[model samples]
Each structure stands twice: as C-alpha cells, then as structure tokens.
Target: MSEVDNYEIVRQKLTLGPLTTPKHRKIRRLLKIFWNEKEINLLSHFGPADEYNSLKQLQERSGLPKDEIKQILRNPLRKGTISKRGTKYCLEPIIPGIFEKYFQRSRDTEENLKKAAILYWDLFKEVLPQQDTKVDNDWSLFRPLLPLEANEKIIEINQEFDVQSQTLPYESVKNLIDKFEQFAVITCQCRLVAELSGEPCKVAPSEMGCFIAGPGSQTMIDGGIRGARLLNKDEAIEFLKETEKRGLVHNAVFDKGDQSSIFFCNCCGCHCGVLFPPKLFHERGAYQSNYSPKWDNDLCTKCETCMKKCPQKAIYHKFPVKSDSSDEQMVLREEMCIGCGVCAINCSDKAIKMVKVRDNVPPDRQKIGNKTFIEMLQ
Candidate 1:
C-alpha cells in the first residue's frame, strides 16, 4: 500500500474509542514519526480495538507466519503499544492507553521521551477546542482525590477539626487501597511528560507516583506490561502517603466513585493531562476532582503560595500596592477548583483548606459506575 493508504489504516485504528482523531495536523505528523510504513504493516495485523484473541487469529488475518509476526510484535509489546493476554494479543487505546508506552520508554530512552512530550503537547493543543464546550453529562474523567488532610500544621490554625465527613472510601487514598485486592506501582505518565518538557516534579519523584490496583492489575501484570509492579495493600498505602507528603493530588480512578479502579495517580497541577490542560483554558477537563480550595483569611499570612501552586490557576491573588502589605489576599473561584487539594497539602500558614462542595460530594454509589476504564474518556 502507498503511504496515504497506510496512514489511513492507522488513523482509523487510532480513532477508535478512547483514542480519537486528532483535530490538528501535528498529531498526524507525530504518529508518522513513531509508526513508519513497516510498523504500520505490523500494527494492521491486530485490526483495531483492544481485544484478547489468539496469535493464530492474527496470523490468519495478516497472512504472515507466526515467527515473522512474533518478531514484529515484540517491538510494540516492549514499547507498550500493545499488550498480551495469555496467548492472545491486543491493541491499546490512545489517551489512557497508548500514551503510557511513552513513559515506559522514557525510563531509558531520552530521545523517545522528548518526542513523546512534543506529541503530547500537540495533541493537547488539538483538544483545546473542547475546553469551552461542556460534556453531555457535565462530568470529568477523574474526581478530585481527597487524601488524609489532618496534618500536624492544621493545629496552628486553631480551628476545630470539622472535616469528619471528609473520611469516605473514595475520598481517602488509604481507604481506597483497602477496597482493592491486587496492587501495582508504575511511573506517573504526566510527571514523566513534565520531566521530558524540562519541568520535573518538585514534590513526588516522577518515577514512583502512579499505582494500579484490583483485578485489572492481575491481567496487565500477567501480560508483562512494563512500568508496573505488584504491591501489597500495606505497601500501596505507604506509597500513597509518601506521594501525599510530596503534595501530589490523589486521583483515584475507581469505577463510578466507589469501586477501586485499575490505577490511582498522584498527580500535580502542572504535569497531569486533565489538570494542566484544563488550567490552561481556565477550567477543569473531562473529570472534576470534586474538591475546591477555601482560603481562610483569618489564618492566611498572605504569602500567595497557593496562587503559584494551583495547576488550574483557580486561586487569584488580590493585592494593592497602596494598601498595607498584610492586606494581600488570595481569591478562589469555586467552580474552577477541581478539588485536587494541592493547595491544602502543606500550607505553611494553613490558610487554604479543601472542602467538599454541598452539591458535589460523592454519591451513595449503589452500583458500579464506570463500566469500563475508558468509558469516561470515550
């Protein structure tokens, strides 16, 4: 087939579900960079979609011998472009799927990481058009994760501990871990993206902040996907606490808001895909973190740290040169805060606190919410 024909097949495959058609030409250019003619030929063997089927099936369709197909498939598997399920092989999606391979390669491949970063930004630009448009359900892909907020510094604020209702399984990272069985730790893709773009995570080490749990981990782990390792319940909780201390927002991807998801990411405002992109457009993306920052003027030292730290730029610093220096203030737009709680993690003055909005708290969740991992994105 000619180059155009080849590009079309790949394009059609990429547009499937979670992966989407790029609204910009740069996305096409980026794809051409990674998937050349030979690679595209091999990829076509899987057809489209992430499904589990035997190698013989692929061989039947590709008309290539098992050995030849295996040779070509090895590269994509190691690169994480595709995954295996026992004797079966399948294609991975784009957004929450194929982009992960870039992080796996980033560990030892700087050139790959840099290229991936460029592509991510380009694709992010492609999605910019959707910023102002509201989702049909007015839902986002992630709920703002509320990790344990009772740090020792809160005592200095001298406020009563009125955050008792905050302790829900979906809101707390530790409790979320308790609900899952299998556990795995992986590199934070967003953090890796930032590092590739020359701004690494200042708090949590980029390599240790992503975690996957539940039955899904069993399948991916057994499939030998890179960038994930099994963890015990206790180990997973400790890692979450460590990430929390680093000031990363906890984004648990549980089904609905109660079922443990395949992964929980310790994300930052600047690097994470959903957070940073929405912040750029002055709003949250497909997912809302379900928490917002509440600035306490009585306890605020007016340091304006929260303003600089917010990924969404939700905090607006209001200060006048003519007024007393202590009059400096930070203002928060309630609708803009996704509730990731980065501002409240370690406030030196304990001024910013994350509170559950009256109408936006997690639902009672009578049944499983997300039927599939990519349902929210698609």
Candidate 2:
C-alpha cells in the first residue's frame, strides 16, 4: 500500500463531531476516489473542523515546498475536504460543513456540480442507515433550529436567561441573526442536492437560504466556501422573513459546540439535511429546537396542511371517536415535536403556537455553558 492509501486516517480525522464511527468507511473510500495520493495527505494535514493550520504549518508538516503545498491545497479545498479561514485551512464539518461547501463555489461546470452533489447525497445515505431510532439518547449531527415565535404568539420565555447576551444566539431568532457582526446567505445545501438529484424541492426554491455569520462569515466569503451576501441587520431580518413566509424552519447548528453561530438556516422537511434524515429514519428525538408546538383546537379546522409540511412527523390528527359532533383536531406529539413552527405558521386557522418546552433552561447559555438543550432531546 502506498502512503496516501491511508485516506481513512484523513477521513476519520475530518470531523470534530461525536459521530466518529465505522459507518463512514464506505464514504471515506468514495471521497478518496475523488483525490490522488498527495491530495489525501494534504487532506490529512487537517484534523477536526476546528483544527485549522496556516500554509506554513502544513508545509512544515508535509516536508513539501511551500508552493507545492499551496497548489496541493487547492484540489481538496475544491473537493470540500479542507476549508480556508482567511489564509488558514481546516477540515470542514461533515454535516452542514461539507454539504454547504460545494454551493459556496462561485462557479462550476453544471456537470461537475452535479457529480459532486450526487457524491454528497450518497455519502449521506451511508450515514443515515448507521443511525437507528431505537437507540436511546439518539440525536442528529445537526438539530432543528426553531426560530423565535412572534412576540404575541410566544406563550412563555425562559425566565432565568437572556439570549440577547453576546455569547448566545438561541434566545430567539431575533437574537440569532441580529447579533452577528458579519452575515452571508447562500443556497440551502440540502435543497440543492435534492434538485440536482432530480427529486426537486417540494417546499421552497433552492436559493440563498443558508447563512454564515460573525468573523467566520468573512472567512467563508474570502475562501469561497459560502457565497457571501454581506447583509446588514435589516437585510438579514428581511431575508429570514422570506423563509418564514415560505413556512421553512430556521435552525441553528452546533458542531463540537461552536454555537457562536448567530448563523441560521431556513430548512424544509423535504430538503434540509438537519430536518430530513432524522424524520426519514424515524429518528424523531434526534434533534430539536428549544421549544415545542402548542395547538388550540378551538381554531383548528382539521387542516392536514401542517401535517404535510411537518418534517419530524410530530403532528397527527386526533379524532373524538365517540363524539356525536364528529370533530377531528390536529395535535402534536410533545415527545417528538421540535417546535420548528411549520404547522403553526402555515395553519390557516392559526390554531398552533410555539411554546417553551424547557422553560427553565435558557438557550443563550447553552452556547457557552451547558449542553442542556441537546441533553433535553436525549
């Protein structure tokens, strides 16, 4: 075996997630087929998603000349293995990490783009089966990022904490997007994958629905990992409103606890990486937002529209089997609900509302402090 044939080492080290396991072996082989020996070694220079190295660091480690190191970095960078942060490069996170990297490219031949998209889609197929809903304490690599319900609709708030603090963005959707210094919106990676794979988006168009914010927004912009829109606060708010109007779910991602993300994504149950897989695999408790859905039957007309849109399948119809009135109502399974607001917003009767699930546990603190929010799902 030649030196770079050891791509498994490169593959295993690519993620900083808790999901490091044998399920990804086939995925590693697929990714290696896309690169050559030296390219995989250059790929090996990267560690976890948070592990970044300067070109100088990589050159020293590889014993290769600086120019060769720079040239070598381009291929894997384009393949979505290594990502650039200013002049530094790190292994991208596998879930939302590598999924978004392809769309970040400013330009690619249509054929090449399709190929890469399919590769990613198949790779995810390998990942999904490895997960079993029967396993207790299961959670997704990415979770549903529930937006803050409109103030009038908000039934309760976590009294102990404020998400408005600089450290945490989950207080509400308001705090998540507004607090970031830099912001860029790009195509929803999952939606794009669905489209290129010919399934098409059942929900919204695959456009600029994902975002990168804070100082890292600039990194994505500079590295071409995410097409940067550079939105100001108002533009960002309006951008999020676009998703809300379309009934898409807003999710904040935390991989290895890099929750500094005031970064948010508008996801559809049909196409979102975070929302689709868990539901597809019957892994309901795998991911959740900070809240759950509250339904008021007084306003509901038994509309199944929300049920069609719920990614988690958390909403179901309940009938009064013995009642003479023959009234049926849409209800939520509290244990499975992620509070993503799909049913609430799309309801013509407006019967559903998002209420605090872990009212005592503050979302803002979860970024810097406890894993209570994620723990709640488990």
Candidate 3:
C-alpha cells in the first residue's frame, strides 16, 4: 500500500482493537506523528473534524518538511489525535479521561474484560523463562486459607506484626491499572524449583490479572501495571471461584471496598517482589509464610530425589547412614523455604508432608463495609 494508505490502515486497526480496516490504519499512522507537540494541543482546543485543519493544512501551519510531517503522522504516539468519520479527519486529544472512558466502554460490557484478562495471563506465562527445576516436598504452606480484607486493614495487620510494608491500597491498584491500560502479575519461581536438577523459574508471570480503575498520576510509574479494577466482597468471591475453575491457584484477596472495587489475589514466594521487599528489610531472606516443612527421616530413603526438586534450594543430602541403617536422610533448611508444596507433591515415596506453624488472623469485616472503593479515588 502507499504510505498514506498504510497510515490509514494503522489508525483503523488501533481504533477497532487491532482489528482494523485498511483506511483506519492509515489515519492512525498519520496522527501518531503530531500527537505530543504544543501545536497539536493548541489545535485540539480549537474545534472538531470539520473545523480543524487537514493533514496538509497542519503540515503548512507547522512549517515542517513533508517527510517530517509524514513521520509524525505515522508515529504511534499520535494515534489518539485524529478520528476518521467517512472521509474526514477530526481533532481528538488522548487525554486520560478519554482513554478511561474508552476502556470502560470496552471492558465493562459482555464479559470482554474477563476474556482479556485470561489472554493476558496466558501470554505472561509463555514469555516468562524457567530458572530452577527443583520440586518442593513441603505441603504445609499451601494449606493456609487465603486472606481477604480491605487494603487498609491489611496494612494495619502487617504493621501490627512488624512486617515491613509493601501492600498497595485497592484504590491505588485500580488507579495504576487504569492509567497504564495494562498490568502484570509477577511471581518468583526461583524458590519453587530450586531443588531440581535443572534451572528454576526466575520470574513467572501470574495467571490472574487486573485492570486499573481511574486516571491519575500514581498510575504512571514504569513498574506499575495498568487497567486494574476493584472487586467487592461478592465479586472477590466470584473471581476466586472462577479462577479456581480455570485451574489457576492464588492466595489472599485485597478488598478496596464496594462490590465493584478492586481486589488482588496474591501468590507468595521467597523471590516474589511483593514479599522480597519486606523480607529484605526484616533481614529474613525474603521468606513470607506462617508455616514450615518437617521431614520424616525414617521414611526418606537417601535417594536424594527431594533434594533435586526443591524450588528454594532448601533441601540437601547429608550424613550418609552407617551400613546397617535402611534409610539415608535429606536435610531441610527452614529459613530458606518459601513453603510452596512442589517438593511434597513430586516425592514418589510419599515421605514429605507440610505442617502449619501458626495461623494468620482472619480479615476484619467492619473495616471493609459495603461501599464502592472507587469513591476513595475521588
């Protein structure tokens, strides 16, 4: 296609969710070129499609070379500035409010949001590289019930325990998601496969994802995931049920407030960023668990199988028995364990088991009453 035609094609594609008419694509390409300039912003305040100058008019007005004009129009940054209706170009600003409305319209109807979330999760897993291959023989860490409560209450509880703070409020999470238009669920698989012979997963993205709730400055940070929404109590329950049915495991639910407020179902690991910060500050080596694993030496056969499958590198073969003994034992370092039950499930001899050390307090109901957490954003 001609350069003009190509720009039109890109514009159409972006407008129509990557499924664009050729003409639309061309328009998108052209708009990207001039999007961020002071002149474009000035033009935006002037008027709509008919009132605003055409591409040729803009090129002449800006006094830029033909190639430079073409470059700006074709750039991805300017895609939000021009709208195509029939055969006309219109001035449109890609302000936060406009983007929010667009996303809300797309994700709020017909369960499209859910489908997008699932797709994002799938893509995340595929892109993440595997680091450790060791299996966790401990099962106790997985047994604890997931926590659900208002974001504020979680912060309070963590403080009470003297745990270093890293939790984000539900409103904050939503705002981040909304501003970025995408967010990722990052998991540390390093400890999960540490005991295995091969490399463990250094970073595994989460299968559960969320979208942002509003437009704001806090949501623009690079590490932040965008497009997050809050899930109220009922919605949180429903989300868990749906995720479970899909075979994705998660722990903890962050309730921001109302039925539609944002929530995050967290998964724990020694290497995960959320737990890492607290672990480092506390000098606890990044372990975040109330339970630890115990081994039955009598049942362990010194075959050293468990040692090969630990994700946290917590297990090792040591002290070979005298000739008379039937069992050779593997040692577990409690401090190094993250408590994911990978090793226990992988053990062939059924010798490994997890035991809970202490229980976490249940979430407080009074703090997270029935109001939309989005109200807090305002």
Candidate 4:
C-alpha cells in the first residue's frame, strides 16, 4: 500500500480509541509528520486503543517476520505510540496516550518538539472546546484529591448507614501513596506543550509532573521514557506535599475510571488538560471529593491567601458597597470548587477547612456516571 493509504488506515484506527482523530487537514499533517511510511504500515496492524494483540498475532497480520516486527515496534513502543500488556500490545489513544508519549520523549530535539507542539495546540483548541457541549457531562477521567492535612468532618446527615467510618485509601493523599509500591514521575504533558509554544506555566515546573503509581508504573520506569524518574513511597508522598505548596491540585486520573491504573497529576489551571478546559468549556473537568472548604470569618484577616492560591479560581473577595464598612469577605464559590483542598492547606491562619459534603467514589467498571470508555470511543 502507498504511504497515504497506510496513514489513513492508521488514522482510522486512532479514531477508534477513546479520543477521536477528526479527518482535518491539521490532523492529517500531524500523522504524516509523526509517523513515517514504515511506521504507519506497522501501526495499521495494531488494534484499537483498548484492545491488545499478541506478538504472533501482529506478525501474522502484518506479514512480517517475528524479529522484523519486533525491531520495527521498538521505537514506537518506547515512544508510547504502542503500549504493551503482559504479552500483548495495542495502539495508544490520541490524548492520554500518543499525544503525551509524543512530547515526553527526552531525547527528541527541541525544534522538533516545538513543531509538534504547534500542531497539538491547534488540535486541542479544535477538539477540547467541543467537550463543553457533550451530552455526558457528569464525570471526567480525572478526580480531585484532598490534601493530607486538610480537616475532614464526616457530616451525619443519614441515619441508616455509618458515615463515621475511617477515610479510605483512595480518598486521602497519604493513604493513596501507601497503597502503591512503585511510583514514577514524568514531565507534565500539558505544561510541556505550553512551554514549547512559548507560553510557560506559572504554577509549577514541568518536571514536577504526573505522579504515577501501581504495578503499571514499573513499565514506564523500565521503558526509559525521557526524564522518567522513579521514587519510593515516602518520596512520592513528599513530592505530593511540594505540589500542594505550589498551589497545584492533586488530580487522580483513573484508567477508564476503574481502580486498575491510577496516576496523580499535580495540575494547574493555566495549563492542564483536566483543569484548564473547565474554565472555557463550563463543564466539570474532574470529580470532586466529598469535601468543601468552610471559611471562618473571625480567623480570616482578609489576607486573600486562599483567593491567590485557589487553582479552581473558586475563592474571591466580595466587597460591599461602602468602602469603610469593613464588610469585605472572601467568598467560596462552591459551584466552581473541585474540592482539591488547595485553599485550606495554604490558609496560614487555619481559617479554611475542608468539610465532607458528599461521597463520590470511582466506579468499579470502565464507566463513570452513564458514560463508558466504549461510549466515549463511539
């Protein structure tokens, strides 16, 4: 087959993933620039993002020798275009998969990365804004995690079930670190893109990026993803603390919203896939924990620390009509808050505390609310 035919086939396969690749001129150019004729031909043999195929299956399908097929896959495998399971491999999705791997390559030249960044930024503008009008708006792939020191008061609203139970591992940042043995950190894909586009992040450095845990993390560490760093459980916890100090939200992204694979992203509103889109799209980007910040008027000196520190832009000073009235108070916009606990942790006077408002646990299957990974691909 011709190079154009192979690229088109690969593009269609990519569209079958959780994130769609629209048949636009920019997308076509992006695919052409990223993948060569041979690579495109090999990628055409892979299944959708969610489906894994064995080596023998790929060799047979591609009509290539086992050694040749493996050799061909080496670069793309490390590049994150193709992800491997136990003994199988499959294509990565466009956003959470290929786009990240494409830019995170530490060995790639700065000029090449910047060129790719331009295309990706354009694609993001074209695609992400449309999410605002999506029919399913209840949940996102990302969820907020409350700070370790943030106060949690279990509100006793229901009489039947016990709401006084201890906090679960998934609910608390400290516990979540303890639950994992392997941990790894990589450059923030969003901030990296922004920096490459000559718009740097004001929140945190790109190196202080996603904190990935669980058994799956070992694959990333072993794969030699450029700048991928491994950390112990204790170090991981400390790293999370630093992100909080920088006013970054701890966003836990689940693999298809299932407990199978989870990563904690220290996200900033200025350049985060999950957090920034909410500002323009008016849609919930990440799931909120059952907590909301409760302000103490007496303790608050109107320092506006919380206002400056809030990643959600949820806190603001509400000034009264009279300047001498001394009625100005910081208002907590509960509707805008993702319950990240950034404000409470940054409040020096202990004026703000996170209180349990409701319960929201990640789903067991590959579904959140009424949406499934399959539905997303569709």
Q: Write the per-residue lDDT of candidate 4 for residues 1-378, one digit (tens) a residue.
A: 643587778777774423566677777787776677787888888876657788889888989998888788787765556666677777755666677777766445576678777777776666676644232335456667667554343222333335553344566666556567778898888888888888888888889997777765676677666567988887887888799889998776533243424566789987787767656665456776667788778788888889998877878998767777467788987767887888888878878766666665665554433234323321
Instruction: Give one clash count per candidate, in the order shown.
Output: 8, 2, 74, 0
Q: Which candidate number maximizes lDDT?
A: 4
Order by lDDT, highest first: 4, 1, 2, 3
**What are the runs in model 4 whose C-alpha is more than 4 Å off?**
1-4, 16-18, 54-67, 105-110, 132-139, 152-163, 178-184, 213-221, 230-237, 254-262, 322-327, 365-378
Candidate 2, residues 1-378, lDDT tens digits: the string is: 665455677666644444442436556654655567878767666655556688788888778888898888787666554567678877654544554554656255577667767766665555654554332332343445544445445334454446442123443566555566557777677778777877778668777577656675666557665345577767777777777767787766444244524455777766666556566666553345556677677777886888877767777877777656456677677666676766776667777766655532322333212122222111
Q: Report lDDT per candidate.
A: 0.61, 0.60, 0.35, 0.69
lDDT of 3 by residue, 1-378 (tens): 643333332233232211112232222332433344543433433333224245566556556665665455443222233443333344332211123222222312334334332332222232211212121322111211222221222222322334433232322232333334333332222222121213233333333433222233234233232333444434545554443333222332223232123223333333332233233333222223443446667766667666665534668887746786545567777766655444554455667664444433323221112212232111
Against the true structure, candidate 3 reaches a TM-score of: 0.32
- Which candidate order results from sorting by TM-score in descending order? 4, 2, 1, 3
TM values, all candidates: 0.74, 0.75, 0.32, 0.81
Find the candidate with the highest TM-score and give its number. 4
Lowest lDDT block of 10, candidate 2: 368-377
In model 4, which residue pairs have backbone atoms overlapping below 3 Å? none
- Better by lDDT, candidate 4 or 2: 4
Model 2 CA lDDT for position 221? 58
Error of 4 at 21 (Å): 2.3
**What is residue 372's positional error in candidate 2, in angstroms?**
17
